[model samples]
Target: MTDAELDLVFKALADPTRRRIIERLDDHPGQTLFEVCAATLAEDGSGLSRQTISQHLDILERAGLVRTARKGRTKIHTADLSPLRLVAGCWLGRFIQED
Candidate 1:
């Protein structure tokens, strides 16, 4: 990933809610907005509305950390591990290995 992509990824993960969303997605590969909202609400019981979850998904999608697709009436969201893997392999990996 380029510097800007890394910046976006970090920025997206900076929010606690977004991070939780990522974790949830990691556990549940393909989840709809309702499923994600239910999971979030179950964890905290604060009840995140669909709109709020949508916004979080938007941020993740923009950062290239997540992907969205329409499935009939619901929109399915899935985690994209490529960016994280890229960063880990290129940026973080470089630090641990000798030149």
Candidate 2:
């Protein structure tokens, strides 16, 4: 991933909420907005509204961390790991020296 792309990835995952969402998506792929919001609210009693979650998804989408598609009336969101893995292999992987 390019430096700018890496920046967006880091920025998107920097937020705790966004990180949690990513973790959830990692566990369960192709989750709709309602499903994600429900799962998040179930885990956190504070109740993250659908709108808020949508905004978080927007940020993730812009960072290329997630992809969204329209499925009838609902929107399906899925995690995209190519950029993440590319960044890890290109940037983080380079930092680790051979044993």
Candidate 2, poorest ten consecutive residues by summed lDDT: 90-99
TM-score of 2: 0.86
CA lDDT scores, all candidates in order = 0.87, 0.87
The clash numbers for all candidates, in the given order, read 0, 0
Q: How far in Å is the alpha carbon of 94 misplaced in model 1?
A: 2.7
Please give each candidate's TM-score: 0.82, 0.86
Off by over 4 Å in 1: 96-99
lDDT of each residue in 7-84, candidate 1, tens digit only: 888899899999988988988988998898999999978677789988999989999899988888877888887888
Cα lDDT for residue 4, candidate 1? 89
- Kindly give the stretch of ten consecutive residues in candidate 1 with the minimal lDDT sum: 90-99
Instruction: Write the residue-wise lDDT of candidate 2 on 28-88 in tens digits.
Output: 9889988998998888764877899999999999998888888888778888878788877
